[model samples]
Target: MSDHLTVVDHPLVQHKLTLMRRCETSTSEFRQLLREISLLLAYEVTRDLPLTSRQIETPMCAMDAPVLEGKKLALVSILRAGNGLLDGILELIPSARVGFVGLYRDEETLEPVQYYNKLPSQIGDRACIVVDPMLATGNSSAAAIDLVKQAGGRDIRFLCLLAAPEGVARMREAHPDVPIVTASLDDRLNEKGYIVPGLGDAGDRMFGTK
Candidate 1:
């Protein structure tokens, strides 16, 4: 898609996201809402997956049926909070290959620090969708995408629960080829580089960690 950013404004997604934004949402509630919303976002992200027909026979009928054309798409989670989004998307595309890129933002610099990386063997052969719950500074996301490319991943797309305009701009400048999909693009990043009016630190909210 030519659009660099896609905001999944579907009613279901928006409603669930609103629930997630509430400060009092319990850990269980936040997790459940994220799972539900990720499925909807996944549906949008995978909408154009190439299709081909496979022959199938029924008791009284035989015909070609549409099936995904190639290797199942790759779903790469950008660590920690990304796992929250990953779990739900996997429920929707059960056959997808999974990968992970672990990164932590350096508190002082607000830049990404890589801690771990693993990917499917045939990353290049499958469409890749990278998942993260927040796109704040975009440093980590861009760095994660760099690792994906280094591992031979192409046709990559980014999916996030929330994004800031600064983060979107950062991605556009760093990896214009990769399009981003998010539930909402908030106003701007605060001085600390967090998305203003974001649902707080996604990892903390998702896992009930400090």
Candidate 2:
């Protein structure tokens, strides 16, 4: 509905996200909530996917029904935190191709560096969805999308569990053509780069680490 990022306000998504935000939530519970919320978010993300008419046999007579049109989906998880969202999305779209982009922050430059990359062949022809839990600074996320585009991924979408306004603004400026889907858009980023009123580090929480 809005430009740039689409916030999914579904009651279930909000309810589960609340559990995820609580300080007492266990690692197991947090992981479960991430999967559930990501699945719910996936439904909204794929809402406008193109469809084509297909001939099908009903209980009695033959009928023409609508089926998804175009190439299979290419899911690129911005590794570590992004993997949390990937598992649930795959459950919903089992046949979707998978890709991974490993990036780490350059402490000095505050930039993103690619450490790993593995994507399906002909990424340009497929519809690509990049997943990440939090969009804090937007440097890594933007860099990941840039790599995807360079690999020929023209139709791209970004999915996240939480987003900060600063990060959203950065993404809009960097990649306006790629729409963003997230559960909530938070107030702002703190001095340390953690989102204010944010759900904390997604990778550490999901994996039960510091």
Candidate 3:
């Protein structure tokens, strides 16, 4: 709570989250709203990106203007659901390098196993942002971070649409160096490892699956 977690509580972000939480939100609407909300959350998660000044000539006169410093960020998506957030964030930071960690949770054991892995070269030189919509159990997210670290990602952050208390604790224990940014930190995870009062399976809603 002190150093690791960040909840984007902006008015527009909250309002869009409420619309997304409803049972009746259509797939198209949910996707669109998520895109809109991700734009706002992007502002919060990347708030601390380093900046350096470069001399540039403006319409008025030459000035030392601020610009992003160092290599572009590496935006890593944790498989299918993560792509939802990834799309919108990419819209905002078009030059960011992209990567993916394909993982799915084992239902009975509630553990994450990797199925695919790809990362940008010189990832250690880039700040990494991992995007996944629901931080339910945190197993998959933590495992995804493990892959990122193995691939030489040093500076990393996590972003989600909703997070449960259990999931946050799990992530804190596993990767204290990585910060988490989300739309809402929810009540708890239900018996089946779903976030209580969550917007149901985000993948189902986003892809219109059962």
Candidate 4:
């Protein structure tokens, strides 16, 4: 709901997203397109990264140039499909510190529980971006954000390929300060909690599963 939550509607992003939505898209093509879209989204996500002036000698002459300033960003992948997004973001910002958080849904309780957690040292001082391909129920994503917060990550943002309205509302209610970026917002979750008309299970599609 906040202005910070930007839905990137760039032409390139839209084109790739359309291809990704096709049921016929091969796993290889889907993965490739996700990576490409991630890179394009990264450009928009990092547009506000602080820049500092530095003197550098170019082929022409020494001139003041703008370079990334202060602490490098920490890109955290929320496991599985999140890793796909991480690959492309890393391609854009190769020097960014990387982290991972893995969570699984407890069948009976339907709550997310962490299985793996690894974050950069001194996360409080770094801007953190969490990547997950889909924001469906928002349970896992919210839990991942909680894990990042416990690790001292204060400045955080989330990125996803698709999100359900319920998921976005849940996220906003739970963590209003953390803005989310996604390509599209679907209607709502079905009885099974899958985003209606969603591209299906991102993990399944990305990994070539049922």
How does each model score on TM-score? 0.97, 0.97, 0.98, 0.95
Over 30-93, each residue of candidate 3 has an lDDT whose tens digit, in order, gives 9999899988999999999999999999999999999999999999998899999999999999
Pairs that collide, model 3: none
What are the lDDT figures for the candidates, one per model?
Answer: 0.93, 0.92, 0.94, 0.90
Collision count for each candidate, in order: 0, 1, 0, 0
In angstroms, give how far residue 129 of model 1 lies from its true place: 0.7
How are the candidates ranked when ordered by lDDT, highest leading?
3, 1, 2, 4
TM-score of 4: 0.95
In model 3, the runs with Cα more than 4 Å from the true position are none
Q: In model 4, what are the clashing residue pairs, if there are any? A: none
CA shift at 158, candidate 4, in angstroms?
Answer: 0.4
Deviation in Å, model 2, residue 66 alpha carbon: 1.0
Better of 1 and 3 by TM-score: 3
**Per-residue lDDT for 8-123 in model 2, tens only?**
99999999999999999999999999999999999988988899999999999999999888889999999889999999999999999999999987766667899999988888
- What's the true lDDT of residue 146 in model 2? 92
Q: Give per-residue CA lDDT, model 4, range 22-78, as digits (tens).
A: 999999999999999999989877777788999999999999999888898999999
- The true-versus-predicted C-alpha distance at residue 104 of model 3, in Å, is 0.6
Residue 9 in candidate 4 has what lDDT? 90
